[model samples]
Target: MKKSILFASALLASSMLFADSLKLEGTIAQIYDNNKTLLIDSIYGGQMAIKVLPNTEIEMDDCGIFGTDKDGTFKDLKVGNFLE
Candidate 1:
């Protein structure tokens, strides 16, 4: 099946310790619900597996396309969705 890709504006996360967080933009190549992880084909030129913790925050912020931001759950994550 063909996969869909989504993009969003840059994300800036701040921590109390002022540490810089690693940011990546990528396409969701695969989803592993059993492990709560995603296999991402990164635009940076490689594939990475990211584990989504229970505390992970998921949001759909496509104001330009969807008109508003929506809180998202793990079930909302599908193969091919762009993540950053």
Candidate 2:
């Protein structure tokens, strides 16, 4: 049916938008609070800018604390910290 075809097409298109993701893991090079952006030193060997939205979840990996690590905020993120 036309509805089925349209739904499939829409699903395929949306999937394509998320299909080409490259993982970048590196240290946080800088934070620009005014611009709401963070600069990361990419593992692939360079720095790139990633925008920080108010709702963006940033969490740190801590092994020994034994409880919720603490909700992240921009102020708690340090420039030397590693991230993915």
Candidate 3:
């Protein structure tokens, strides 16, 4: 029983480490034709895009080159902007 409990705990901890959180930020490299998706250049130096849900809020910071704007959209978020 003790061994089983230890194993379970270890597995849980390892799983948590590998879990992916969905806080994405990046430049809008390309907007899909449907407009529901866009290609983003992630701050981590990878290109990826995710579908946006209805009524979702996109926020950004207020400083830096691509800082967040008053409308929650980042400033100068063109094809070569950095996002976090």
Per-residue lDDT of model 3, residues 19-83, tens digit only = 77657777778766566666888877788986755665665446877775554532224556555
Full-model lDDT, candidate 3: 0.67
Model 1, 1-84: lDDT tens per residue? 123222221122234334545777998999999999999999999999999999999998666865888889889999989898
Give Cα-based local distance difference scores for all models.
Answer: 0.82, 0.85, 0.67
- The alpha-carbon deviation from the true structure for residue 76 of candidate 2, after best TM-score superposition, in angstroms, is 1.1
RMSD of each: 14.6, 5.7, 6.0
Give lDDT tens digits, candidate 2, residues 20-69.
Answer: 68687999989898988889999899889989888988786776758556
Residue-level error in angstroms, candidate 3, position 22: 3.4
Q: Write down the TM-score of every candidate.
A: 0.70, 0.68, 0.45
- TM-score, candidate number 2: 0.68
In angstroms, the error of model 2 at 22 is 3.6
Best by TM-score: 1
- Steric clashes per prediction: 0, 0, 1
Comparing 2 with 3 on lDDT, the higher-scoring candidate is 2
Question: In candidate 3, which residue ranges exceed 4 Å CA deviation?
Answer: 1-21, 59-84
Query: Where does candidate 3 have its weakest 10-residue lDDT segment?
Result: 68-77
Worst-scoring 10-residue span by lDDT in model 2 = 62-71
